[model samples]
Target: MKKSIYRLIKFSILPLLFICYAIYITGKNTGDFYKRFSSPQQNSLILGSSRAASMNPEIIDQIIHSKYPNAKLYNYAFTWAHSPYGPKYLESIEKKIKPDTKDGVFIVTVEPTALMVDKNKPDDPQYYTENDKSVAKTSMVATNPNLEYLLESYDFSITNEFNKKIRPEKNPMIEVSVLDNGQVHGKVIKRFSTEKRKEVNAEKMAELKNRINELKISPTRLEYLSKTIDFLKQHGKVMVVRMPVSKVPYDIENSAVADFDKIILDITESKKVPYINYNNYPNNYQWVDEVHLEPEFMDKFSAVIAKDLVH
Candidate 1:
């Protein structure tokens, strides 16, 4: 019995421990969202959906250093489904920020989709899409491993997560890495041909049009956004930004919410913060799809934003 138990410990327990250690090491690369949860609490933060996730904090910091020398910005932005402007995201933001942060930079990215809900049940928080997601469910946001997030939020098996790092996918269209600074870096490995890119954009635009009726602007989301601005105000300066999208989806957004820009303008004006609308800016930027900027443009875009922040 003693010999059998010793063998079991050697074969089973030791291997399990090694596997767990492997998973913990590769956890950050397993998904785009894991590293965001695993990192320490941030002083400065960039808040929005995936559109804002690509903004390089390093570039922003370098440019803004002359003004706010100690600003250490982390991109806490997730996808629209997970991080739309709402109570849950605000709660997570509050938890992720350093308690004594003062004179830190806060960049809040906005778009119509972020503030939308089910048209039929716009008032019901239960029906809100993000309520059941990581932003809402994750109570501990500043742990190294963030086992709570891994257990509750991660969809794949630990084996799969481990395999992702050990045996990576070959020739992926986009390779995404989460930096220590909390930026989601996406490298486009396979660029679509111009014709193929146009085709994909059209498909995305069509999908947006089809789903437009299912969603409606939510007053709760808007109020929570204002509350988020108010909460961040105590810590530092807040800047509202609308990242540029391709004209196809841009027009769709305007049609979906006729007063989108006006609404954002009103909020910025009332809050006395800067609102930079890149949609009206020059159309020289490139996109991976209709919404997100290509990896090459991220640093350039961050530089533009940083320059604006200082001025």
Candidate 2:
């Protein structure tokens, strides 16, 4: 009986060791592959959902470096990253900031839907797909600056050849490229013709409207936002920004969330932080879709915000 038990233990331990080694190798390869894609600096952080991902760190840095030469900004935003994830993410990246770092500016884009909560409803998996890469995987490597964290969080799906093949074209509606500076450039994928683009935009806009209608600002999320502000204040100045959507969708969102500005204003005012609302951007800046601007306008938008930030 003892011999049989020992044999079982030997077999189990060998398989466990092999699994551990595989995890380590998979993580090392993928982590190194993605390391070429993100920045190492962290004096400034851009935080929000996909909206905040649009801000180009290089463009913003160019505008501010003359005034604050030492400032290094990294876009830390991810898709479907709302208030629920913000506080934890901020905490996770604390070690990345240098001990002597000062004048660290944190720009956070406030998306209205992030404030809402519906406990009874489960989130759509499509809303939070890790079809290609996981922010948590890349982020763990970024903040910890080690292989262990990266290995522990690595998803096995990344190893699948089928997943790799489709990753480049994941999310046919919006194609995003995350650069070394952590700036994510997203383009609306217009397949065949202008008519197809219009059709896609209309469907997305309708879905967004439906989601907006069901949104209810949760007290818990508001509390989390408040905590996030307080936590960020420990590092440096904080700015709350409201990014612009196209006219029709913007108007619909405004009508749905009556106290949107008021809520943001109250938080900023109480926290003594600045709030920049670009919801009324001039007609000249073109939009790729209801919520995102075309790449041509990204630099202009970043310039506007960076100018304000430096001043």
Which candidate's lDDT is highest? 1
Which residue pairs collide in model 2, if any? none
Please report, in order, the local distance difference test score of every candidate based on alpha carbons.
0.87, 0.65
Which regions in candidate 2 have their CA more than 4 angstroms from the true location? 1-41, 81-86, 93-96, 119-176, 186-192
lDDT of 1 at 52: 93
lDDT of 2 by residue, 1-311 (tens): 99999999988998778555644444333322343222355777887777667688888888888877877788776655322343344444564455466677788788777666543454432332232244433444353234444454434443433344446445576554556666766656744478877898999889888877876665655666787777778777788898877787878778888888998899889999999889755656766666777787877888888999988
Report the lDDT tens digits of candidate 1 across residue range 65-158. Answer: 9999878889999988999988899999999999999989999999998999988774667788998898899999988777898789878776
For candidate 1, the per-residue lDDT at 193 reads: 92
Cα lDDT for residue 197, candidate 1: 81
Q: Report clashes for each candidate as comma-separated counts.
A: 0, 0
For candidate 1, the 10 contiguous residues with the lowest summed lDDT are 23-32
